[model samples]
Target: MTKVYLALAHQRQRWMNDLFQRGYKKKLKEEDLFELEERNTSSKLCDEFETNWKLVVKNAKQTGKRPSLLKAIQKTFGVRWCLYGLLALVKTIRLSQKSLTTTTTGEIINLGATDVLRFDFLPQYSQYILIGPIVSIVFVFLLWQVVGVSSLAGFLVIIIGFIGYSLTGPCFGKLRNKTALRTDKRVRMMNEIVSAMRVVKMYAWEKPYASLIEKMRSSEIDKLLQSSYFRALSISSSYVANKVTIFAVFVVYVSLGGRLVSSQVFAALTWINLMRFPTATIFGWGVEYLSESIVSIRRIETFLLLDEKEASILDDIKINTKRNSASIVFENFTAAWDDVNLAYVAENRDATQRKTLENINLQVNDKKLLAVIGPTGSGKSSFLNAILSELPAKTGGVKVRGRIAYVGQIPWVYSGSIKDNILFGEEYKPERFRAVVKACALTKDIQSLQEGEETLVGERGVTLSGGQKARVNLARAAYRENIDIVLLDDPLSAVDSNVANHLFHECVCRYMKNKVNAFYESFIMYG
Candidate 1:
């Protein structure tokens, strides 16, 4: 633990000095480049790894060997090669998801529940399952035709086939439900842990919470094991069916020669082709690692390849005065998350998927204070996000002018020092930086620490209190001096009323002291 903390502390110090001297290698707001993200989570990452991560994700149109039909056939021919294939599949899925988020933001809406529930039919999974049975029947029927089997014998074969088919369905159905439910559960559980880490800390219930989550993770492993068992069973069942049919054909040929013109081995070969569809249909259909990765590939591919809306806003407008800020305009416009009238956007059609915000227009003047008020989920955050350029506005709908800085609610704090959170890989302006620290009432918070500004905050700034996190976020927004606009998304919502009042006063006094640019303004969307 000491070594871990020391290593983390050293990393923070290096980044602190680095940001001061060099800053981030690239700007985040730049439209042309994807921001570099260098972190990985172990729990939810693909277990079925793939070496060809870049190949699968980079150009989905050109399907390569990783987790494709071609590769699957190769692996089937030589199962030893499958170990390499499975490893490659994992990396492929992870990288694909990362690329998609990098390229697309607005358009990747969830599929309709009904459509998603038919996941079994998706080509990645369904083609194998459906083809296996169809091929099996076709092979058997063709063999029967060639041999000229009697009506009674053919009827008996069909009855046996039907009985054999019935045994597999119930197990396959359970596997399907288990695969889906478990994956969904893992995703949701992860969200809860990260988003609500504050609650766990405040309650001092980390151990219990972690234990419970680990238990859930263990359950997922168990589910996967169960799926593997059933898949093996499925393969075994196919062999059993083939052996029975082969034995029957041989006995008939031996007892009554000349009744069978071709050897039974030839017929077995036909039956082998027929088995393809069912083997693919039942077990491989639902919960195989390969099938899961394929499902991920589609979502990740669309995300990586989806066209991003070009940055059309004018960033070089000439200033009428030497002002740092500008006003914003929202024309007569309406926004809905889901429009019942929208035929093409058929998904999220449920009325229960309530509208985030309706048609309303408001103007925020330069160097002015505006408070947007509404209950939680009443589009308050939506309104703020629209102005901040995080949410998309219709062409000609949002006409925002001037430079802007933002402080988000529940703002992100990295796994570093309190000061690093404020710096955020930016070139430090010593005077302005110190001013921001004071403005946000963080000087005292820093003094309480052992190493002051250098104090390591650990992951998500877990070492700091909630109110302290808010302060660091506030300082980040307040760091710039010649700012045109500052948008605070409930900056003081977490602090005491008195502290909030003091912080707001400090912010105003600092702004008023500076030569106010015609564009300079501060806004409290949820003030």
Candidate 2:
């Protein structure tokens, strides 16, 4: 019976190995397979084989690839089916772990970048970690009882191991706290460098900035080293605890006058050896993973719990039900960009609070123009933002009856061909495209390029000149069809006077005169 079981196990293993190899060959291209095989040859064959097997299984499960199997038993009970289910479970676990890690890291990054923090999802993670170990303990106790290995010596060994595991908890906590602080410092340093890179270069402060960054990096590394030392100590102590348990068990057995009979002694030794792996896994690696996961969970929870901007109250209030003639209306509307004031109002639900833009009324009918003229700090942009619902309305409402297009003061361009940037995912109409290019005075610019309209613009239009970028930005907004209202925030300021005049005449007057135009401060009109 024993020999038969062993033979069956070996056959199952062989069959699984063959399936894995076949799956891998099918999934990866010939060149990739060759590369992997070459790399595999340099490593220990057994280790490489196991890794390849897992990769194949993971790929098959992920891609939903049909596995090659014995035709006779494929429909019914078969080794292939069993292995497929097992592989799927493993893939699911791996995917979940990957997603959790990604989400935790993203949340941490977001929290570090943002000003506010909250703790909404911490309880869920706390409950999971707290319950998991308790359930595991229960299962271990049940398994021991069922296996008939419930001896005083075994119990004592477990107790000692538990104590050792408990000792590492404080060390892990301290390490995790230190790690969070270091991570925050590193992120802040990187953010500062990125945001102030141009200024640093212009002012010849690169060396000073570099020194500051290096100092923070060194501090982070120091923290990491300290954490690693504690981690090593914890792992070593766990290993020692396992060895001590084994030694103590034998000593107790011998001191109790138990005969060193082969069956009794060997059974005890075999059970101890079997328990060793699980003991180390649970008390050693498990504790370390749990501690890290807890810290990440807390960070993520804090990020998720932050007070978000209230969903536009206008979303719930249906507008223009009566087909109102007004293209845009702002009635007793107030707006604010003050973060503290907004947050306070959000918490207090106080609608009477004064904001940047006080209670004001405005209306623009279809095919009309509204030129808002104000000084730099007079909330001119805020007025436009309020109309677009970019800023919160403390009281009253804004009503809009048409699709709006907005071009900001700082021209934004993405990395793509000039044509792609202009088209902006809209269907190409050559006549409309040509008209827009001419209207925005981009014809000469496009004609000058070797690739013409197909020329690739570097990230954020870095390849284009300031005027070229502004023209392209204008072209994008101009090319959009069915725009009822266009909001221009000093779009002409970046370009030359002649180009700006041409843009206002051809694009704003000729092409978009039929649409309602809202210009914040900088306004130009042509009949």
Candidate 3:
């Protein structure tokens, strides 16, 4: 397998070199490159391991073996643990999305890129840590058969090496913990810099920010260098230990006034050499990986334990097709973005004074257009957030009986065509698409573009104007079928008076006339 892989790698490298010499080109076909069909694709390998792991987990249950360090070691002795760890990491990531308000992007990145990978590399040598001593004992017995009491000297040397690993393993883990934190800090700062690059450049703050990032990077590198030094020590010690153990056995045997036969000496030496891998090499790697894996698992555990979004908060919300029913009803409802305060308020209703949206009673019947007017930072968006179940409820309850769509205050767009953004993963319907485009006042903007709705918007819709992005966001929600209530979080704030008027008249009052709509604004508007 190694030889085949090496040959394939060389072939691909040569092909890549040729392609680079020809210059990079767009729309390159897969057939244009030299390729080999892989029998073991990642998906196939994962599926195979998953099938095996299910059986292993079932057997473990039958044996009544609960999760523990021993059980984990037994179960993780194979490559399947990599898949197990990855699946768990993915599930944790999904559950952690709501809690991301407190978690930094860099921390999440390290969890996926650095921490999850420790599981993959661990099983390769983990068993050696357990079997290292047992194998050493067996080798000691074998050597004693050929060299009698002299074998005790070799055993002593092995014991010392074991103790050395035990002492240093935790120190390596501590260094790794420090390194991982520095990595997260550096990555988080980089993400902030990338996101705010425009502002940084505008103020000519490039050098200062660059210096800050470099300082962080230097700290991270220093930790990594310390870890490298420790790893070098492990390798060098293992090599020296192997030589010293053999020498000690020979000197002790000769000191016993025993005449050494060539056959017995060579036989004893062979057994000691055989013990080298288990005692020195594999044991060293196992200890290193074990320490690193422990740190990784703890990091992942911390992330998994972060607060998840309270998706079940709106248990009173029910879908109803009846038009006579109220689309949304707020009965003495109070909500707050800070769940800590909400939890306190949960115990004592008097603490509801700190809530973002105080107890309020309101109802919007089906197809009604209700406008919520509030000043900046006066909880206009928080009101929408409460309905969306994003804010934790403090008092009373909110009941909804219809499917709702929301357009946030800040429009979101990914790297995709205008039409794709408008479709938003919904099936494309030509007539509905045309109507939504015209209703959201996006028809003119689309027509002015070279590719019309098919034009690529680039990342975050950078190529489009703010008004255009807002309309695109609105059109996305409007395109969805059977939406009973629509929440607009000051959508008109970015557009001109004319465009806002057009959106209000054509989109809200006319196109979405049958759906209950709520508009958030700083001041009341008759339109």
Each prediction's TM-score versus the true structure? 0.55, 0.67, 0.79
- What is the TM-score ranking, best to worst? 3, 2, 1
Residue by residue across 19-138, what tens digits does model 2's lDDT show? 578777787556533244442333433344335544543564487552221221233223332322111111112222113322344334644443112122222233333443454455
Candidate achieving the largest lDDT:
3
The parts of candidate 1 lying over 4 Å away from their true place are 1-178, 190-233, 258-325, 336-359, 373-379, 389-396, 480-483, 512-527
Error of 2 at 281 (Å): 2.8
Please provide, for model 1 over 1-527, each residue's C-alpha lDDT reduced to its tens digit, 9 standing for 90 to 100.
Answer: 99999999998787466444433665434454434433222222232222233344344435522224334224332343332222222222222211343422222222222113343244344444445445555655666655545222433553465455445445545654555455555556666766787777889988887787788778767877886786676566556655565566656655666444455457645654455445433434433433444544344333333323324543432342254457777776455433332112225566554445555576777656666655556676666656644445433366666766677777678888777778776787788778778888888888888899989988877788788888888787677644666677766777876677767777644543342221112334324
Residue 222 C-alpha lDDT in model 1 = 83
Among all candidates shown, the one with the greatest TM-score: 3
lDDT, model 2, position 398: 82
Per residue, candidate 3 scores C-alpha lDDT tens digits across 291-400 of 98888866764564455545455344542545445478889998665554210122534443567888889988887999888889998887787677666566887777
Candidate 2 Cα errors over 4 Å, as ranges: 1-157, 163-167, 170-206, 251-265, 306-326, 339-354, 522-527
